[model samples]
Target: MRVLIAPDKFAGTLTAVEAAQAMATGWLEQAPDDEVVTVPMSDGGPGFVDVLSAALGGELLAVTVTGSLGEPTPATVLLHEGTAYVETSQACGLDLVPPERRDPERATTYGVGELVAAALEAGARRLVLGLGGSGTNDAGAGLLAALGATAQPDGVLASGGAALAEVTALDLAPARARLAGVEILAASDVDNPLLGLRGATNVFGPQKGVAEERRVTLDAALERFADLADRSLADAKGAGAAGGLGYALSLLGGTRVPGIETISAAVGLPDRARAADLVLTGEGSFDFQSAGGKVVSGVASVAGEAIRPCLVLAGQVLVGIREMRTMGVESGYSLVDLVGRERALGAPRDSLVELARRVARTWSR
Candidate 1:
């Protein structure tokens, strides 16, 4: 039997490619005679470029950009034909900062803007910007600055969320000029608004180390920046992605699209699933959000359309069995269910291998 294995990054544990490899190892260990095809998937986040590059066969152009804390960071931009693919996480992801050092107040998306500028210099007209895993909450103030929105005179623009308070005026005309003919698409799985409880600051700021006491101030600062930019785009979907990088890109005519849909279509997942005998996909956690424009749901949709059974394996299964079935998933295997949270998080590769072996014995037939 031919098995197609594709999974998203298991967050803090295994990446998409690693997840697929582990599942293949386990499946092949049990059924060595069976064939396994591995394809990793990402919902426009950390592994977006790698996944697309693998599928699209592109030239990877390397450039130096700023990290979240203003250090020189090396990043890759995938150039396929006339389109350029850039993942924000490659430059300013939260993973780049250690847990103790996380400070959204000082984080910046300046590197992301640098990547876009580099892509433009390469003659890219269509920009696919994957917006996730960001460490900043300055509402793209740093990105705007990098794209030529300095604070007037020789004074530099403030670095992070806190400095947005001093952004008395912004000049996006230069950026607009640079991106005049470029088509920007902000790919994001979340549809969070730019400001409010579900907005950038309150929902994502804590993850980037913005203390509870400082959320209001950062939110207010973002509100002020939005007031100066476009106050009406606050409620737009995807506006809150990557800690408000979505809202930032929108300033340059960036439109939002579901991350999973964008990636699936670009990589031809529907066609791949149609030709596969069985489809296996998973993620770090299969929860309520898994059904809402995430990698698992997107994979399941394509598999279902092909009348193929799609099984999900995860670190934890927060969504119920009925709900999982309703999403067209044949079943789900959980590391937490087999072992425990500690083992699941600490040794996910082993647990996943065991789970896949068991699934092959029980479900593979």
Candidate 2:
């Protein structure tokens, strides 16, 4: 039997490559005779550059850039041909800020702009930015600022929705000239709009540490930014992703495309899974989001078309067997339930491997 293992990163626990290795080890221990192939995957959020770089050989270019907190940090971008892949999370990811200091109002994407500048300086003709895991709701104002674009100073130029109220002007001439010939692609997984209740501020503000009472203020701020940009936030799908970074990229001539679709096509996942008897996939949590165009769902869709049973192993499985069955997942397993939540949370890698081995043993029988 040919088994294909393709799983996303276990969020804060393990990377996609690490998860694939653990799964492969367990499968080999239990099903020694079965041919197992590992294909690490991401939703074009965090770890996108690393996963894509590994799958398609690329050179890693590291440059010094500012962090979300305005501190200087080293950020890496993947260079493939004339196109440079930049994962914004490397500069402004939520993980970089501590829980106590996790205020979206204070974070900035200036570092992301720096990354783009570095890529441009390196002679990259095109830029692919994975926009997710962001800690700010600046609507890419800070990013533009870093790229030499002018914006209203003072008040809140970096933080949550309230900051949008202070924006008095926008000057993109510098950025336009700097990136005149470069094509920018803003890869995102979410389809949230830019304004209103379902827009960037209202939908993602709380998660980024915006208080409930402050949501409306932030939402309105994003609305103003959208207006200033001469674009209707509500009309753009994925405009709310990365805290209105999608909208910012759109104004900057960046094309917004389904992250999973882009990654899947780049990695040739569908072609590989077509020849496999069983395709294994997973994520941090297998919930409704999995069905909403995540990597796992994307892989399952392809596997289903090829008539292959797609098995799943998650860190925590919220969806039951019946729910997952509808998405072409024949069977689902969870490390949290198998090893107990405490143990599973403590050492995810070992727990995941053991759970995979146990599942493989069951398959062998």
Candidate 3:
């Protein structure tokens, strides 16, 4: 029997590649006669560049840029066949900031702009930017500023979302000039707009430390920035991704593509699933949100299209078996369920290995 293993990053615990390796190790231990193939996955988040590089064997260009907290940060841009792939999380992801230091009110996307500038300087004619897992909520004001979009008095947009309310006017011509003729793909799975109830601040701000009371103020600041920038694109799909970096990309004429679809097609997941006897995919938590445009659902969909049996091996499985079937998964196994929560969190890789080994006993022939 042949098994194809694909999984996304386990949030803070393990990377996608690491998770795949752990699963493969345990599966092979239990079923030595079976063949296992690994294809790590991402949904336009932190591991976007790494996964793409693994698939495309691209040249990684290292660059230093401003981090979400206005500090120097290191990131990589994957250049392949004149197209550059940029992962937004490397520059401004929530993982970059410590929990005690997390401040969505002041975080910025300036590093993302610097990354794009570096990619352009490397002679990339087409840019594919993966957006997700950001820490900032500046509505991309800092990114625009880094890309040469200036305010009337200058330095008005220097700060993050907190300063957007003070902006009187914006000049986007310079940024447009820099990106002219560059085909940009804004990759993301989020569909929330830039502001309002279903928008960036109201929906994602809490996770990044935007208190309930401060959400309204921060959302209004984004509204002000949008008013000065382009209000029309503020309500566009994925505009809220990476804390409104999607909207800024729209202002620069970037086309939106679902992050999963972009990465899935690039990796040829459908064909791989078709060739496999069993398909395995997972994430940090397999909950209701897993059915959304996340990595697990994306992989399950591809397996379903190929008429293959898809199962999930996650750190924790919150959804019921019925919901798992609805998401195209035959069954779901949880690390937390096999081992206690303490061990699951302390030794995630080992816990997953044991869980996979146990599951293999029942599933593998």
Candidate 4:
């Protein structure tokens, strides 16, 4: 029997690579005769660079850039041929900031712009930016600023989403000039626009520590920036991604690509699934969101295309059996359910390994 194992990062406990290895180790231990293939996956979030670098041999260029809080942060750009792959989360990821110190209104994406600049300086003519899991809500104001766009009052649009409310005008001519003749790909799965109820501020602000009362104000601020920049692109799909970094990339003429699809094609997941007897994929939580543009859903789709049975082994399974069926998953298991919450949280690696060992006994033939 042959088994294909693929998984996304289990939030803070483990990266996709770590999760895949743990699952493989447990599966092999339980069924030593079975063939196990591990493929770590990501949905253009935190582990985007590392995953792509492992799959596609590339030079990981190290660079220092400004972080979300005006501090120097170290980041990397994967240079494969003339294309540079940049991960947004590397610069201003929410994990970079502590929970108590999180302030979405004041966070900045200036470091992301610096990362782009570094890529360009390294002679990259094509840039693919992986966008998600950001700590800012600045709508890419700081990014544009780093690329040579200027606010009328200088410091009025220096940083953060709240500062956009005070902007009187912006000049994007210089930024446009700098990105000329470059192909930019915005890799993300989020479809929300940049403003309104379904937009960046209303839908994602709360997660970044935006107060309930400040949603409308921040949304209006982004609107104000869009009004001065490009109002038309504000309603475009994925404009809300990475705190409107998608929209800013659009302003710079970046084409949007579904992150899962991009990674799938790059890794040739369909062919791998077709060759495997059973397919297994997972994430931190198997919930309704897991069915939408996530690694688990993408892997399940690939497995379904190959007429193979797909299973999920996640940290927690929050969806019902019906939902699992809808997701094309034969069954699902959770580490938290198999072991207690304490073990799942405190010893995630061991708990996941034990869960995989148990599941392998039933699934492996």
- If the candidates were sorted by their lDDT against the true structure, best first, what order would they fall in? 4, 3, 1, 2
Clashing pairs in 3: none
Candidate 1 lDDT tens digits, 1-365? 88888899999899898899999999999989888888899999999998888778889999999998988999999999999999999989998888988888888889999999999999999999998888888888778877876564222343887777766777788888888889999999989999999999999888788899988998998898888888888789989999889998898899999999899889888888888789999999999889888899989999999999999999999888899998989899998999899998888899899889988997665
The numbered model that scores best in lDDT is 4
- In TM-score terms, candidate 1 sits at 0.94
Cα-based lDDT for every prediction: 0.88, 0.83, 0.91, 0.92
Off by more than 4 A, model 4: none
Estimate the TM-score for candidate 2.
0.94
Lowest-lDDT window of 10 residues in candidate 4? Answer: 150-159
Residue-level lDDT tens digits of model 2 in 258-332: 888888887888888888888998887889778987878888888998898888899888888788888889888
Q: 211 in model 1: Cα distance from truth in Å? A: 1.8
lDDT, residue 92, model 4: 90
**Could you report the Cα RMSD, in angstroms, for every candidate shown?**
1.8, 1.9, 1.2, 1.2
So what's the TM-score on candidate 4? 0.97
